[model samples]
Target: MKAKIHVSAAILATLCVISFFSITLLVELFGTLDQVAWIKSIIVFPGLFILIPAMAITGATGASLAKHRKGRLIQEKQKRMKIIAANGLLILIPSALVLHYWASLGQFNLAFYTVQVLELTAGFINASLMIMNANKGRKLAHK
Candidate 1:
């Protein structure tokens, strides 16, 4: 039951991260806010909905799993998650706020673009970290 919970949460969180990254990439490729406003709305709605809940689940399940495992890999995964959480708070959250503020004001200027770029970069970094953590979890599971 614990393994299932952990794996399911991790998979869901990973999927949400990937979806967010892909949507951001598509928004960038679409070349302008005006060009992808509808798609942005689509992504934002479900992305926020799923991402937050999935992240919560992932964190809780990961903690539970780690408590049961006294292994180096689990330690590494915990360290990676801590870094990911810190990066999310420091980089991603502020970038998202700036992006939202600028977008709300209909200010798609260089500053808005800069924030968007930063947010996307942070998102990808978090996603990569999550991927590494997931891989470690898988290895631990098989052991």
Candidate 2:
């Protein structure tokens, strides 16, 4: 049951992270936030509503699974998870806030672009780390 929850949460979290990345990319490609302000606002709703809870579930289930595993492998996974959480808190969340704030105020200048880029970069990093963690968890589960 724990493994099922852990894997499911991790998978869902990965999908949410990827969705964030894709949306950021689409916004960038579309060029000019003014053109797609509505899209950004719509995306923000899901990001806030879905991604946050998914991340929480991922962390909780991951910790539960880690408690059962023993040795250096578990320790390493824990370390990576910590980094992932830190990245989300420090980089992704803040960037999202900055983007939203600037966008809401109709400020889509260099600052907004910079924040968007930061958000995208952090999102990709989080996604990559989550993928690695998921692979490690899969191995640990089958062992």
Q: lDDT of each prediction vs. the true structure?
A: 0.75, 0.77
Residue range 72-104, candidate 1, lDDT tens digits: 898888898888888777886566556655665
TM-score of 1: 0.86
lDDT by residue (tens digit), candidate 2, 73-109: 6887788888888988898877777777678788878
* Residue pairs whose backbone atoms clash in candidate 2: none
Q: How much is the lDDT of residue 57 in candidate 2?
A: 83
Estimate candidate 1's alpha-carbon lDDT, on a 0 to 1 scale: 0.75
Off by over 4 Å in 1: none
* lDDT assessment of candidate 2: 0.77
- Number of the top lDDT candidate: 2
Root-mean-square deviation of Cα positions for candidate 1 versus the true structure, in angstroms = 2.0
Residue 25's lDDT within candidate 2 is 88
